[model samples]
Target: MKHAPRLTALLLTLALLAGLLPAASAAAPQPAEPRIAADSAIVIDYDTGETLYEKDADTMRVPASMTKVMTAYIIFEELEAGNLTLDTLVPISDFAAQISRNQARYPTAVPLPYGGSLTVDTLLRLILIPSASASCVAMAEYISGTEAAFVQRMNATAQRLGMTAQYQNCHGAHVHYLTARSQAILVREFIRRFPQILDYTSATSATFNGTTYPNTNQLLPGLAFEYEGADGFKTGTINAAGYCLSATAKRDGRRIISVVMHSDNNTTRHTDSTALLDYGFARLAADAPYTDTAFHWSWQAVEELDALGAELHPSGEQFRPEQAVTRAEFTAMLYSALAADGQLPPLPGPEESTQPAETAPPEDTAGEPEQPAPEPEPPFADIDGHWAQAYIEEAAALGLVEGDQYGRFNPDSALTRQDMMVLVDNFVELPEANGLGFDDDGDIALWALEAAARTTAAGLFGGSGGRLFPSASATRAEAAQVVSRVLELA
Candidate 1:
């Protein structure tokens, strides 16, 4: 493949803009906004192809082991095209075995015994899950007869995917120019074409040849800092590249892909990735429209409640469709909506202090002063002077919300999807379970199973791809829509 000089110039321009080149940083200080520790980072909505957040996203940097994502992509394409089968055994070359054993810098190397053999599927798993560099080169040679030819294919794939990256090696040992944006795009395409790759990326541990290799992507299950709904992805590290990661997650029917390149350290890569995922979810929620859309079925109900003069967000004009609703905020919105329909009593005003003013101790009863009524204890220790204190207390009084076992209502925490269903069950009579089969029914918390069934039957919530993500947090707009649906049912 012919390397483009223009690509080099573009990379140089981005490096200068990001203050990545030594001379560029020496020229001036970097900008302050979008403060991330990574040299290049980006978060994009997988479904809509929208970039939610970016910081030096286009800056060219070494991809390191992230090149395996492309390698796996090509392998999957080959599999689908009938060029390779999972059972096809690839002979372990002496060079592949030497690279695996000698590469002390790549800690994830798996011993590929020379004169032995392994299946294409197993090697692909090693390349993806543990990011084994030996497996990468072995697969490269097996597919194209030479690493040079495989490098050509990698560059061709990048070009076909509209990525402006330059790959010198198939295994990503030396410096290879790739941007965070290009990585995200590659992952997006990979997911679009072959979502089954998640099986490899999401595996917590894989056993091969009597050795168990843990996946390097720490966000997967049974690892430190495991994120809810996290599945497949990849992580990379090299002296030159620092720590890099390309992660993807799905929650509540929304999917996001994030890439962090050249993080300061391994821990920082995961932290940066977690922050990017949070930001992506927040961006999706913020960009979620209140009017007609996929959630458009709730549009009329929202409008109906609006017509009834029910004010959900007292501080905002637009209904923030994608923001997570806090426990206190949901309580307030529910109380107000119920009050509007007269299904619940009007919200009480602030109570006056029960302590009577001192009026000379009431001279007639000076010898027997009346005792003042004891003040009601605050509902939660955390909400003493909070703005939502009144709403929270009233909700507790009405039995709409019960404090957790710790005797504290975590008022500021995001209300969960299942918890929203249980809260709705308190006021409305939920329909019987209509046998709406969900793939994740067994994963639902025991306490939430009944509510999940009833809510699904009542049309209050639905499954995504046949799986009900019971633990996913409910957004502010989702809460409002559920409240509107409840009002209509009433």
Candidate 2:
């Protein structure tokens, strides 16, 4: 037991980023394997493409409004290739406006101005957030001369993403058929590739030129069946589709994508999704490496950090929760936790970045002129030698950390609570907060005080017996706690 071979953690990154293998954090009272009311359903882990649950996933059924996800995917591809910009105007064609005018004839259509145009961005919002069939037709016409051409593209893209489907229309009205697995794969790929689509799908409501549009997905925030952390994808309901839905949510940095097709009603669609989501989370919780934190106060936090990935601690059996964490360790943990939550710092500007500029494709085969790569940042003198070096350096590259004015990272020094709060401030905008009312509030470093107060109100920091040890070195446990709370906030 003494020489456990550095415990490459068959437990938490001792909760580090390799992911808490074996859910050594173990199952937090998991629910039984879920049984759904839908005829076809599937649940998948967003990161690893692991199948967590499924039922008749390959059987074909009507897609209904779920087709908008495919439309949105094609639109994102256009945007990425610079073929279309958010500002690009898409004139509502007579054909599209005609459909929207008859909500009686076409129940899912939004009332669009037949001759007037809307921006590509606004149209996308209408299509995804509200599942507006008219908007979908408008975009289809703008992208292709006719809706037929856009349908061809959707089928081709579906084939490329390994989805099985026969797409009849942009809005899934003409009796579209897609397997539950295909829908899940479509959503997984959509999120993996164009997560920004969430900006629309997650919206509870949107105001168009003169009217308001509410999202059809009931699982998102401020809705009938609000599931916490649930954000995107689409919902489909029609006589043929029979209440189909594809739902996606993120919790503790792990994302779950679920698809339920051919449920009896709206209630069953959401309930089945909830069951699948619950089962998927429980399954994930029971996953990964092994370690016990000796039932510390930070057990939950440690579990959360471990959930981000594998750890590199020398001992798998013991996490040394009371150990005073070094600067490198804290920053590395923060980096992993934030990344798991998909909270990456924004990319540097073109002038400062080596990444290619977001330029549109050229008219001919002549490709973009290559730009010279930027110079590599000089290594932090005290950084490279640390085991957490890669994580620390990555954090530094994102401007999430910096060396002391002396150019030394001082990686080995103990991280005080004051410093921890300051580092967190770099990523999260601390909302205006009331006084923390900690006995040691006045003792906090002046620069860190405001951050401390804000974080305190955020419940990212807490006091014991009305005292916050501002200058005290944060232990591994405390750091884990802080990171987990930040994950919740994100």
Of the candidates shown, which would achieve the greatest lDDT relative to the real structure? 2
Clashes of each: 1, 23
What C-alpha lDDT do the candidate models reach, one value each? Answer: 0.76, 0.78
Error of 1 at 73 (Å): 0.6
Off by over 4 Å in 1: 1-34, 105-107, 291-490
What TM-score does candidate 2 reach? 0.59
The local distance difference test score of model 2 is 0.78
Candidate 2 residue runs with Cα over 4 Å from true position: 1-30, 290-490
Report residue 299 deviation for candidate 1 (angstroms): 11
lDDT of 2 at 217: 85
TM-score quality measure for candidate 1: 0.55
Error of 1 at 426 (Å): 42
* Local lDDT at 482 for model 1: 85
